[model samples]
Target: MDNIAGTKSSLVWAVNIAVVVLVLLWTIPTFGLLVSSFRDRDQIATTGWWSSLFPHEASLRFRIGDAETQRQEGEVFVIDGSVFEAGGTVSAFGTSNRDPAAHEPGEVVDFGDGISGTVNEDGSYRVTSPVAFEGRSPRLFVTSVTPPRFTLENYDRVLFAQGLGRAFLNTMTVTIPATVIPILVAAFAAYALAWMEFPGRSLLIASVVGLLVVPLQLALIPLLQLHNAIGIGKDYLGIWLAHSAFGLPLAIYLLRNYMVGLPREIIESARVDGATDFQIFLKIILPLSFPALASFAIFQFLWTWNDLLIATVFLGNTQDQLVMTGVLRELLGSRGGDWEILAASAFVSISVPLVVFFAMQKYLVRGLLAGSVK
Candidate 1:
C-alpha cells in the first residue's frame, strides 16, 4: 500500500508537470502575438514582445526644425525645439548619425565652422551658428530610457490601409452560408441513413467513410472545371458549393453515427403515433441531436472560416471577394518585415474562431464522447 501510494503520487506530479509544459508551449507564442499587435512598428522592430512590458533603454535619431525655421538671435543663427513631443528625459545626444548619443545631454558640442548645439535633459535642443545655417536642419540623436508604450495603430493600418477589414467581411460572407447549408443537407441525409431505410444505405455510408481519406487537393482542378462548365465560375456561390461539398462527408458521418446511437425506442414510438419520417426527424431526432449538430457546426464553421486554398481556387482575389487568409498571405508577401501588422492581422483573423470554439466546446466534447461510446 505504501509503495502504491508513492507510485501514484509520482505519477500525479509527472502529469501535472507535463500539463504545465504543454500549456506554456501553446500559450507563449499566442501571448507574444497578442502583445505585439498592440505595439507600434518601431517598438516591435527594436525589442521583443516580452521586453515591451517594461521601461527600457532605447535610442532614436531625428532632425530638428528645418533651417528655414531658424531665427537670428543675438547675431547667431539658432534652431530650437523639443526632440520628444510628449516630453521625455534624454540621457545623451549627437549631431551625426555615425556617432549617435556621442555626447551626454546638457553638454554643448561644437561642430567645426562655428556651429554648436546643446540638448537639455528635458529633450529640448538648440543649435547656434554665427553664420546662417545651411543645407538642412541638423540631425539630433538621443538615447533615453523610455516607459512602456503601446498603440492600436497597427490594427488601424491592417484594417483600413491593408484591407483586412474588408477581407474579414468577405470571409464572413463565405463562411456563414457554407457552414449552414451543408449542415442542413447533411442532417437530412444522416437521418435517412440512420433511421429511414433505403437501398444501398450501407454502400453509401462506406463511400462517405472512404471519402474521408480522399485528399481535397486531388479534386480541386476537376471541381473547378465542373463549376466553370456549369456557369458558376469563380464566384462566392461557387466557393460556397465547394466548401459545402468538401465538408459534407465528415458532417454526414458524424451526424449519422450520432443519430444511430439515439434510443431507437423513442424514434419507433413516434413513428407508431402516425408521425411521418420527416415529422419524427423534426420533432424527435433534431432536438436530441443538438450536441452532434453543434459539434459539426463548430467543425464546419472553423474549417470554412480558416480555409485558404478553396477560397483562392474558387474566388477571385479582388478586394471585394478576398478573404482574411488571402489578405494575410498578401501581407506576408508585401509587408513581410512588418511584424506589428502581421501580428494584428493574424489576431483579428483568429478572434472569431476562438470565440466559436470556446462557445461550443462543451457541446463538441459531449457529441464526440457520445458518438464514440455508442
Candidate 2:
C-alpha cells in the first residue's frame, strides 16, 4: 500500500508539471504579443518584448545645429545643442558615424584645426573652433539608457490610418449571416434526420459524414464558376452562400447526432398530445438542443470569422468589402517589417472570436461530450 501511494504521488507530480508547462507554452507568446502591440516602433525594433518591461540602454545619432546658428565666442566659433530632443542622460558621443559611441560622455575629443567637442551627461553638447563654422552641422552619435516606454499609437494608426476598423465591420457583415443561415438550415435537416422517417436517411447521413473528410479547396474554383454563372459573382451574398454550403455538412452531422441522443420519451409524449412534427421540433427539440446549437454556432462563427480563401475567392478585395483577415494579410505584405502594426492587427482580429468562445464554452463542452457519449 505504501508503494502504491508513492506511485500515485509521483503520477500527480508529473501531471501537475505537464499542465504548468503547457500553460506557459501558450501564455508566454500571447503575453509578449500583447505587450508588443502597445510599444513604439523604435522600442520594438531595438529590443525584445520581454525587455520592454524594464529600462534598457539605447543609442541614437543626431546632427549639431547648422553653421547658420553658430555663434562666435571671441576667436572661437561655438555650437551648442542637446543630443536628445526630449532630454536623456547621454553615456557616450562620437563625431564619426562609423563609431558613434567611441568616446564616453563629458569627454572632449579634438577634431584637429582648433576644433574640439564635448557632451555632458545631461545630453548638452558644445563644439568650439577657432574659425567660423561652415557647411552643414557636424553629426554626433549618443548612447543613453532609456526608461520603459509604451504607447497607443500603433493601435491608432492601424485602426484609423490603415482602415482596420472598416475591415472589421466588413468581416462582421460576412460572418453573422453566414453563421446564422447554416445553423437554421442545418437544425431543420438535423431534426428530420434524427426524428422523422424518410427514405435514404441512412444514406444521407453517411454522405454527410463522407463530406466531412472532403477538402474544401477542391470546391473553391467550381463553386466560384457556379456562382458567376448564376449571376451572384463576387459579392457578400456569394461568400455567405459558399460558407453556408461548406459549413452545413458538419453542422448537420453534429446537430443530428446530438438530437438522436435526446430522451425518446419526451419526444413520444409530445407526439401523443397531437402535436405536429414542426410543433414538436419547435417546442421540444429546440430547447433541449441548445447545447448542440450553441456548439455549432461557435464552430461556424469561428470558421467564418477566420476564413481567408473562401472570402478571397467569392468577395472582391476592395476597401469597402475586404474582411479583417484580408486586411491583415495585406498588412503582412505591405508592412512586412512593422511588428507593432502586425501584432496590434492580429490581436484585434482575434478578439471577437475569443469573446464568443469564452461566452459559450460551457454549452460547447456539454454538446461535444454529450454527443460523443450518446
Candidate 3:
C-alpha cells in the first residue's frame, strides 16, 4: 500500500508540472499581447510589452508655434516653448510619418538661414527667428520625453468607435444558433444511428463520414448560389444553416460513438417497460449522453466563435450582419497600428470559448468514461 501511494504521488507531481509548464507557455505571450493592446501606438512600436510595467522614456519633437501665431512677445522674437522633455533621448525629428526621424534630436542640427530649435536638457527647446525671415508657415520640428503609456483607448476604440460591441452581439446571435441547431439535429441522427434498427444504416453512416473529407472551400460558391436560389442569401438564417451543415458531420460522429458505447441492457429494459423509442431516447439515452453533448458543445462554440472564413463567406460581411471576424478584419485595415485595440478585440472574441471550456470540460471526461466499463 505504501509503495502504491508513493507511485501515485510521483505521477501526480509529474502531471502537475507538465500542466503548469503548458499553461505558462500558452499564457505568457497572450498576457504580453493583452498589455500591448493597452499601450500607446508609438510606445507599442518602440518597446517590448513586458517593459510596459516599468517607466520608459522616449524622444520626440514638435514645432513651437505656427509662423502666423508667432507674436512679438519680446524683443528677441523668441520661440518660448520646449519641444522635447528631459527623460527620453531625442535622436531624431521629422515632419511626417515617412520623414519622422529626419533630424537627430538634441543635436541642434542646423537648418539653413538660422531657422533652428535647440532642445534643452529640461526637454524644452527655443527656436530663434532671423528677425527678418518671413514665411507663410513655421517649419515644424518636435522633441519630447514621454512617460510609460497605458491607456483604455483601445477598448474604447474597438468597443464603441468601431462598433465591435454590435459585432460581438451579432457573433453571439450567430454562434448560439449555429451551435445549437446542429447539435439538436445531430443528436437525433446519432441516436437513430446508434440505437435504431434500419436497413442501409452502415452505408448511411459511411456517406456522412465521407462528406467530412470534402473541403468546405469547394462548396462555398455553390452554397452561396444555392442560398440565393432558395431566397436565403445574405441573411442570418442562411448563415446559421451554413454553420449547422458544416458542424453536423463531426457532431454526429462523436455522439454516435458515445451512444453506441452505452450498455445494451439499459436500452432493452427501457423498451421492455413499454417505453417507446422516443421515450427511451428522451429519458434514458439523453440523460446518459450529456457528457458527449457538452463536449461537442464546447467544440462547436469555439469553432463558431473563431470562424472567419465561413462567417465572411456565408453572412455577406455587411455592417449589420458583420460578426467579430469581420470587425477584426475591418480594424486591421483601418487601425492596424493600434495594438491595444487588437488585443482587446481578440480577448472579447475569445471570452465565450474560455468560459464554456471551463464550465463544460468535466462533462467531456464523464462522457468519455461512459460505456467504458459495460
Candidate 4:
C-alpha cells in the first residue's frame, strides 16, 4: 500500500511539473502573437510583442518655430516659440525608425548636415541650427517612456486595406457552400454505403477509397474543361464544385466508416416498423450519427476554408472572386514585413477553426472503436 501510494504521488508531481512547463512554453509565444497583432507596424518591428502588454517609454519630437520666425534673441538666433516650456530630460533619439535609440536625450545629435536636436524625456524636444527650417518639414526624434500600447491598426489595415474585404466575403461564399454541399452529398452516400446495400456496393466503396489516392492537381485541367463545357464558367459555382469533388472522397470514406459502426438492430427495428429507408435515415440514423456528422463538418469546413490553390484556378484571381488565402498570399508579397498584420490575419483566419473544434468537440470520439474490439 505504501509503495503504491508513493508511486502514484510521484507520478502526480511529475505530471504537474510537465504540465506547468508545457503551458509556459505555449503561453509566451501565443501571448506575443496576440499582443503583436494589435500593435502599430513600426512598434511591432522595433519592440518585441511582449513589450506591447506592458507600458514602455516612447519619445515624441515636436518643433517650436519655423524659418521665417527666426529672430535675434539677445545674443542668439532664436525662433519665435522655439523654446518649448514643457521640457524634461532627453534619453535617446534616432534618425530612422530602424533604430530609435542611437542617441540619448539632452545630447545634441548631428544629422550629418547643420541640423541638430536635443530631446527630453518629458515628450518635449528642441532642434537648433544657424538657419531656420521655415515653410518646410523639420525632422526630429524624441524618446519618451510609452506604456503598454495596443492599436487595432493591423486588423483595420488587413480588413480595409487592399481588397481584403471583398476577398474575405468571397472566401465565405466559397467555404460555406463547399463545406455544406460535400457533407450533404457525402452524408447520403455514406448512409447508402453503410445501411442501404445496392448492386456493385463493394465496387463503389473501392472506387471512393481509390479516389483518395488521386492528386487534385492531376484533375485540375480536366476539371476546368468539364466546368467550361458545363457552362459553370470560372466563378464561385465552379470553385464550389471543385472543392466538393476534392472533399468528397475523404468525407464519404470517413462518414461511411462511422455510419457502418452504428447498431444494426436499431436500423432493423426501424425498418420493421414500416419506416422507409428515407424516414429511418432521417429520424434514427441521422440523430445517432450526430457525432460523425459533426466530425466530418469540422474536417470539410476547415479544409475548404483554408484552400487557396484551387480557388486561384477555379474562382479566378480577380478581387471579386478571390478567397482569404489568396488575399493573404498577396499581402505576404506586398507587405511581408508587417508581422503584426500577419499575426492578426493569421489569428483571424483561425477563429472559425477554433469555434468549429470547440462546438463539435463532443463528437470527436475515443470509443467509436469500442464495438470493433468485440
As for candidate 1, its clashing pairs are none
Cα lDDT tens digits, model 1, 1-374, are 55554567777799899999999999999999999999888878978889988877778788888889899998999999888875568888887888887898899998768889899998888989999988876778899767778888888998998889999999999999999999889999999999987899999999998997799889899988998999999999999888999989988989999899899899898888889998998988989988889888888899999999999999999999999999989989998999998999999999999998888889777756754565
For model 2, residues 55-167, the per-residue Cα lDDT tens digits are 77777778888998899988889999887765567877788878988998889998676789999999899999988988876778888876777889999999999999999
> Residue-wise lDDT of candidate 4 within 126-179, one digit each (tens)?
555665455754656556556666788778877787566677688789988888
Model 1: lDDT to the true structure:
0.89
lDDT-better candidate, 1 vs 3: 1
Q: Global lDDT for candidate 4?
A: 0.74
* Candidate models: Cα lDDT each: 0.89, 0.88, 0.76, 0.74
How many residue pairs clash in each candidate at the backbone level? 0, 0, 16, 21
lDDT of 3 at 4: 57
TM-score per candidate, chains pooled: 0.82, 0.83, 0.71, 0.75
Candidates sorted by TM-score, best first: 2, 1, 4, 3
Question: Candidate 4: which stretches are off by over 4 Å?
Answer: 1-5, 8-14, 24-31, 57-121, 125-143, 364-374
Show the lowest summed lDDT stretch of 10 residues, model 1.
365-374
Q: On a 0 to 100 scale, what is the lDDT of residue 5 in model 1?
A: 43
lDDT of 3 by residue, 202-289 (tens): 9989988888678989989999999899899888898889889988987888889889989999999989989999899889888998
